[model samples]
Target: MGIHDLPHALAVHLFFTLSSVVIGLVLGVTLGILLSRKPKLSNVVLPILSVFNTVPGIVFIGLLLLIWGMEAITVLVALGIYATFPILKNTYAGLISVNPQYIEAAKGCGMSQTQQLFRVELPLALPTIIGGLRMSTVYTVSWAVLASMIGQGGLGEFIYAGISANDNGLILLGAIPAAVLAFVLGSLVDLLQTYTVPKGLRKRGSTK
Candidate 1:
């Protein structure tokens, strides 16, 4: 791959990473909320998720490829599911970890279950939730490279090509950008937490 191929590859990589992470965030957080409300269900469900989470990304993608026949949806579904585990686990943890007193206070103030969750629980959980999002984003970037294996296109084209030719330049072309992409995306999540997390919670999270 030439330098000219870099932009398109980067764009494709970003597309896979961002799109999958967004899908995972929505699915994870939604399931997490439901699971938090049902602790017994969470106990059963979370362990199952953990088992799936241990599957290697390449193996997962390859399994998906067999079922879907190298479609972009295969890549998206694989990466998206891989991205979901951390977010789902953390969201459940964060929500359950919210102070019981706050729940009582919200109840005393006439907040409904939904109101208490949106107004208090989610806000308090923002820091932990964001932490999971950061992990998902960074991880998905690396996993997105597998797209090239299926010919869906990403920086992985450069990486795999480099490996075939033993060309370090080509490998660096992909590796550097991927590393930078992960760092940049991870930092954006941190910045998001700074603004979205409550000040007191941010301080407390920082201390921990």
Candidate 2:
């Protein structure tokens, strides 16, 4: 790899990781909130999405490439869909598990369902949701590497080339950066959890 390659690889990796997560978070959290409003719907939809998640990443991306061709969008869509699952599940889980007392209190304050959802349930659910984000971010970093397989650029090119040439050094050049990126992104999400979650709710936060 050229000395200049690392910076370019880093940029590509971050773009893929962050972009997919942003798109995924919007779709996932929206679906999750919709499902949370209807237990029966969550039961049906969540299971279907979970089944999709069971498909291997490469296989899924390969299938998408047939329709989308070898563009970055194909990779982004696959990664976004993959990243959505945990966040959707956690959002539903977190909102459902909010204390009944809090719900009652929100009602007592004359808050409507929407207001209560925005102000009370979501704030309480922030830690769990952010935990899911951390998971998605880390997982997306790993998955983004596969983008190189389809001609989209990332550290995967280095790894794939290293494998082709049977050189560990080249593989490390790719892998070590990917690992550091995942760790750093995951850590940032954790730090976000502390800030985004309300200070009062922070003490009471529980994924359960």
Tens-digit lDDT string for candidate 2 (126-183): 8888888889999999999999999998999889989999999889999999999999
Best by lDDT: 1
Worst window of 10 by summed lDDT in candidate 2: 199-208
lDDT per residue as tens, model 1, 97-130: 8888888999999999999999998988878889
Give candidate 2's error at residue 56 in angstroms. Answer: 0.8
TM-score for all predictions? 0.97, 0.96
Clash pairs of candidate 2?
none
Count clashes in each candidate, considering only residues at least 3 apart in sequence or on different chains: 0, 0
Whole-structure CA lDDT of model 2: 0.89
